[model samples]
Target: MREKLQLIMKHLRQGSLQKMWKQTIWIYQYGRRYWKSMILYTLLGVMGSCVSLASSLISKDLVDIITGHQTGRLLSTFAAMIGFAIANLLVSQASGYASTFISLKVDSEIKNDIFAKMLVTDWESLTEYHTGDLVTRWSSDASNISSGILNWVPNLIIYTFRFISALAVVLYYDPTFALFALLGIPFSALMSRPLLRRMRNNNQKSAAMNAKMYGFNQEAFSNIQTIKAFDLIHFYTDRLKTLQKDYISMRLEFQRMSILTSVLMSIVGFIVSYSCYGWGIYRVWSNAISYGTMTMFLSLSGTLTSSVNSLTSLIPSAISLTISAGRLMDIVEMPQEDYSQDHAVKLFEKQHKTSGIGLTMKDLSYTYHSGTEVFAHASMEAYPHEIIALVGPSGEGKTTMLRLILSLLRAQSGEFQICAGSDHNQKLNMSPSTRKLFSYVPQGNTMFSGTIAENMRNVKPDATDEEIIEALKLSCAWDFVEKLPNGIQSVVKERGGGFSEGQAQRLSISRALLRKSPILLLDEATSALDVATERKVLKNIMQDTYPRTCIVTTHRPTVLNICTRVYAIRDKRCEVLNEVEIEKMVKEF
Candidate 1:
């Protein structure tokens, strides 16, 4: 079982190697933008390593010179060593500055790219990931990548060079001393295997706990009002505590393993140094090696042992960094939907004579993931210049049909088409740009913390003041908007905190209207409004606006009364009411 565990740990460590190379290449690509700075930094690092090696060699020479009473040579060597030390310090500082600058630049670039990708991803796919998870990946995971660039890259290079150079110098003085120092390599390798396994397991648990904690916080903040209304704060708080406990336990276990590894590696270092010292002294006493040579060999052996130990200590962190890089690469390498085809065309055409595109569904069907069918072989059509009302008992697929028409969800089997013009010659599948042909106001009047004008600009970025005012008038919102202290420029809190539900609904309508899309879809748009406000808004939308295709999904009598045609959805089928029947139904409602 232990061997199997060791094998699993080895595989896990190796798994991240490919990702590390990829991340290294990405950092190199980023460094290309500041090649001059990168070159200077690399040169300085090399110089620093050389200075360190020179210092060690100089120490040995000074000891030998003192033993022989050569004061002049000893003083000259001490002065040269001091000057090299200063140069090393200056170069190391400059390299740090350069590394930090490069890291910041690369972090910004990666973050921006990730955010842009999130924006353009398919809505369904994007919704599968929690908002906080994405945020953590973009921020924390990218930070790991940046650290690999700034610290790991340069340090790995310098340490590897120093280790090899130190080993070479020791071996030149006495090959036996160098071999003794090298014995630590296998001991380090043995200790690292189990420690790395423990670390990997702990890291996985810690990451899972973090994701859970972040998810809990995100949901809690987004629905604080509901949590308070329902008095569920303690429930969420307890859950958060559980996650925190798990994270802490995992971190403690990881630290314990690290400490154990460090202690074992230190023991190995001491053994190697003692063995080398004992053998060197015996050789000196036997006159097999001079005292001065023995001293130089001892100094070089100590430096080599330290370098080997440092390299061994870095292995665990390097493994962790590689694992983080693999996670980041998973996101960066996700296969995006192909949107680069010549055949791909916008869903709407300006030359279409129809005021709005007409939708037709022929034998449409859909099912949720749990194998529950929402609709099966249902069909319906809505034309331009009319308002279609969809009414049904709750849980009978009213919203599902609307989503199918909007292309937010695809039909499992059947044909749905948007005939672009009155002649019905132009038909196209929905694309990203085509989604712009319709304006949608969902069940909630969601708003951001921004000025009213800024919210309007979300629908139409370049909308003129006159156009915005006209849209507000059409939505019966201009009166309240004008009453605001700053009119269109008035600041609104998140979700329109200062406005009543009815007022927020009207603001959402005004924003949608500003888009001037041919098709308008209102899914329970006025459900938050009083009877009087609902009547006024419905009247303006149906009577005052120019002929356009409008679909409203609601059970409200006010909406049913104003719609030009009413359709009842029952048993996954749509049935249009006769004119007299519709009028009678409207009158009764």
Candidate 2:
């Protein structure tokens, strides 16, 4: 638990703006794509401020004219005040509309950039982050940052300028009164500092708890079947209750800090208000200031005091904003493997390529972070028009070896290459396009939530209806698909529900077949299917279809009958097996 906490803190610390600015800058550039809206917003802000200040000054003039008994001057000042009020309202409305427009544009652009980054990120790197945590960072965290930029930053700047301008006006009329009004500054700072710290700590905890709860719920719902089958519903419910209790505690802590800050601000406001009024009355009685002047000073006091109070209130929000900014920076700063360089070797167009797709692993070895080696000096080859079968005891690294060959996980030592075409001279390193030259069906047979046509399009977006039907037929999925209410347009719920395990496997096989890639990887893709269905799919790939290069990792000997070559993996070594030896091992099993 301490180790996990330390990891979370490490992420928080790295979320600094200094580390995050490059990505933020890129996002800002995209936001600036709508320069017209930003420009209009800025202009409206300035105009609104001018109109507001003008109204205050006009009110002061009206008071002076009434006191002097000048009817003409009083009427002129009143008219000017009315005119400024109307202008303020119009400018305020315009500013609000413009600000909203800019905010939405920035929000959309940032979300798009984060999604694009997620797509290119290494698969292993992505596994280190929880889906719930990532969702919060992408949605809630980004929203906080956008709010700070669009609303808080702009409002703070405007109010700050207004405060300074109001202060200057107050000083011009009475310097002593202005000094008394400024007393709220240090008092507010003293009260807000500790409250801001408490709020920030609690807010961070709350955010983490929310992420944990989301993850827990997602897991429980996704595995509802397993939970029901095992009679573990009460266990999961108790766990969720415990998480909710913690979340409530954190929220209460935040609210307590907020209440304390509000109480302190109220005290500060009372002190400043009484002092200003008492002093102004004394000055008026002594003839040191006129009634008009005293009235003006009193009016300005409220604006001045509220501005200071607003500043104090903004502190906690600013801290929250900083925390969110740091979170976003963490994801943006994670080291990304560069794929933009020209190191990519074009294997498809090369003349010395083997007759068909072939894969080779030369002295490949891999070790995980826990120092448990999955493979040691492992090597194997799969040629075109043939199926290579890997047989191993559980945990002997069959799945790990398949991942290495597919470049889903990088090898710690040695290399994985595609040596294919006429001369077997074409060597392909892992590149963006090279990685896509093969289709993989993982062990779990996971399927996304979408229509059958949509899932097929994920493999070959431009495939025609006829081509898709052909692939489904080859995988023995056409009969079931045809029986569905919507046929190919049928929607499969998340994880391919509303279908048997065997049916889902057939669909996955069809999806893989649609890729038309040179190499196909089946990591127990047919494990869930019965013997008959599995045999039908295997036979179709080996004899009846375009015989692409294929690798099948499994322990079932019945599944290996169609393979052109067989490898036995034991004690962290891969050894090629002759047909007689394979038959002997099969009989023993």
Candidate 3:
């Protein structure tokens, strides 16, 4: 026991106490919003405890009345007991129902707020966390915070009130009996310090294990087709078994420690109960108290002991809550995307709705957070009604250029903007807000589980069937789409299942075309299509009446002929391709 205290002092000296207090304060902020509901729940619990206390005292009076034949007060005492019992039962039920309602409400509201924050978080900053880890923190950690916020504070108040009141009753009846009831309190307090340190550590490990399993499952299910193709069914199953074994082993270790702690506490509780029992019977034999008094003493003694145990149990719960809050805080407090120029971008879109916007970059420079340079002093321009091509060997800056244009990544230095015309005075700087001015068709099968029409409408939710079909025809996807029984409404499974790669690419292009944005950036979006189809898609985009500026990055040479001009990314700069250079590139392709 002295060693535990020494360790606690050691922990305090190391400044862990301050860190723990900060985490506690962080969690308390969430609980502060639902003050009214928490107060109501606490009141109900206190009311139930008062009624229960009254019931015990009333029964004592009823017992004495029966034994002494006091017929005058018999009916009244009996009626009071029954009424208090029923009221206590009702309050308990009401409190339980309110708990569930408030818990779910708090959980959903916190999740909704945090989910929105996650979407607006800076893209580069957010990529530091894995998808699975983020989901776990957003879901499991958020739920823990809510449950703790709703229940922990109120339960602490309720249990403490019950304990103090019950102790008062027992002490007033006989102080010696109260001492016997408290025999377990000191021993229970001693056990808690060690258990708290272990509980907090175990919770962190458990949470990590859960996230690892969730991530593995999500990745496996996402690549189930590949797993089947490679005949890795048994290998994945064995891997899952290994993870399960590690999870089970971790849980069992914690459980064993918990079981041991409970056993020791229980033994102490038993000793205390018997001591109160022995002392009460002895007092009754000496005629110092009546049978009714002895019965009431036993009842209050049990209550006092239980309340002590309940109070001790809260420490572990508090520790767990603090850990959960810290995990969620790490994610929610990241740098959010800056939308300071959103209104400006919106105004630009409104003014140039018909004329369309032109992308302009001058002396542009960018380096990743890891210090890898993508573009340095690179400049490019794409005017409305022109198809511009970006060509480079693999590992070059082609895709990186598109990301910079989309403002998914920020440039370390230099200028990026969009304008209505040649006049630089009418230009707006690129930012998260500028994303609304452009439509992007990135590489890969980026389809969600939905129908063909639903996928197209993801970009323009109010798009009509006529608009969807027109966009599809431009990408040559309407030919296959029309063959389906449901046409545009036909179901498209996850990752564009039930369709060829080329067909999916065409459908993606169709969705992008439907957006009607002024600028269209295709980052290897047509790689899966045939040379003729790719050329046709580029031509269709270039000829659109909406004055769309198309920029495409590709390895193929066929689409270069249709481009107004081409740029090759080399040595961290965009090198303009002349007629000779363009012809040489086409021949090389």
Candidate 4:
């Protein structure tokens, strides 16, 4: 039974070690560009350790010089010590700078890779993680991985060499002295294994709690106005206190385990120090070793103890790095959006260069992963120079249809295509790349924090003042924009904080218009505007010189007057209605 238990334990230990090694190798790959500096940094660290040991050895020579009555050589011997000191200083400074440079470089590379991956990952898959969790991984976990690659690995290597060199010096004078000094080595390492495991589990939980707290705070602050109006301040405050209490409890538990491991190591360290001292004194009294040599043994033994402690500390650090690496790899390994096979983007770009295209859907079907069927056997078509209105009661997939049209959500089964103008008359299936052919203005104020001109230039970076004005005029936004003190250059707050909902909507529409894509999608973009203003904006859009195929999701009846075709969506189906039918539906509302 004992042998069987030992065999099982051996396999478990090997499995854990193999897993940690793989994670370390993966993190190292991210620092490949800085590997050259990292190697030099480790070499410098080894040299610094060598200098420290040399100083301890030279102290023996100084003792010998004084006791043997060799006073004449004291000046030259002290000069040698000074030389080692200067060399150590230089090596330490160089290693410090190299480590900093490597850490910063690896941090930047990791962040850039994660950011690029997030941009190209499938939209629905990316939404599985909250914004706060993603940000925390990007900022905190990435830094930990960087430190693992550039700092922890190199320090481990340097400290191992230091321990070996110090042990050799002590053993040269008296082998038993080295054994006494290393009595606590195995104990320290063994004590840390369970502590390391516990620390890693606690760290993962703490990280999750922190992300939840961040998400809660972000949601609360973003809806502060709603909370104030509803008189829910105490409710939010109490919720915050609860979250903080949980966080504090988690942290305290981790610290308690760490302190227990520290106490065990400290006890072993005290025993080792006293045993080495007794062994060294006995060797000197028995005339087996000289006084100078005995002094060197004690000094080098202390050095070995310190090096062992440093080495053992790395076990916990390595565990932390493994957790961080695993968190970051979760995002990096997710399925990315396939851009190489996007034939629709190529076709749309070719067709839209000269003229616009109409959208068509045939026998479309879409069901959520939770088995909620959003659309089934749905079909619709709209031509350029035409305005199509998607009218439906709330929760009837009006916005879902607009999202499907924009390729933000893909259908489970269907033929959704875009057919070009008369010249080429090519047909292509919708994909991620096809999104480039459409300019979308989603619900609410989507304006970023920037100057009005800056926001307009986002879709068209080189749009001149004249071009910006033209797009704004097309959206009926120039009226208010021109009245501002700085006109288009006026600074806008985040989410259009200083602007009314109606004004922000017009700005968002103008930014989309500047793109001049073949297709335009307005998903409740005009819900905040009055009837007269909304009507004027739609009129301006339809009369613009460049032709466009417009699809709007709206519950407002006023927009129906200008729509060339109106479709009502209900019960997972879309039905086209004539003007009379639309009038009857409007009256029923």
Q: Rate the local accuracy (lDDT) of all candidates.
A: 0.72, 0.77, 0.88, 0.83
Q: What is the lDDT of residue 235 in candidate 1?
A: 91
In model 3, pairs of residues that clash are none
Task: Give per-residue lDDT, candidate 2, residue 521.
Answer: 88
Model 1 lowest lDDT segment of ten: 338-347
Stretches of candidate 4 exceeding 4 Å from the true structure? 1-34, 69-72, 285-295, 341-347, 423-425
What is the C-alpha local distance difference test score of candidate 4? 0.83
Q: Give the TM-score of candidate 2.
A: 0.88
**After best superposition, candidate 2 residue 573: deviation in angstroms?**
2.2
Model 2, backbone clash pairs (residues 3+ apart or across chains), number: 8
Model 2 scores what on Cα lDDT?
0.77
Better of 1 and 4 by lDDT: 4
lDDT of 2 by residue, 1-589 (tens): 6975875577568774344455456445544555565556656765676677678777767876877733456667788888889889888887777688778877787678777777667766677889988888888888876666565545676668768877888899889889877878888777775676576677678778877888888889989999999999999999988988888887787777778767877887888888888998999889887677777777778778777877777877777776776676667666564565233444352433335667778777888766898888888888777888999888888898877776667778886777764546667765455655678988884778999999999978999989899999988999899988899999988899888888898899899999877788898888888777787888888875464888888777876666888989876778998878888877886
Candidates 1 and 2, the one with greater TM-score? 2
Which candidate model has the greater TM-score, 3 or 4? Answer: 3
The C-alpha local distance difference test score for the whole of candidate 1 amounts to 0.72
Q: What digit string (tens of lDDT, one per residue) describes model 3 on residues 1-589?
A: 7986998799899877777898888887778899998998899888989999998888888887887833448998889988998998898899889888988999999999889989988888899988999999999999998988888888899999999998888878778788898898889888887888898899999999999999999999999999999999999999999999999999999999989998898888789878877888899888777677778888988888888888898998888888888888788788887889989888888888777788889999999889998888999998888899999998888998998998889898898999884353689989989998888999998776799999999999999999999999999999899999999999989999989999999999999999998899998999999998888888887777878989999988777977998999999999889988888878887
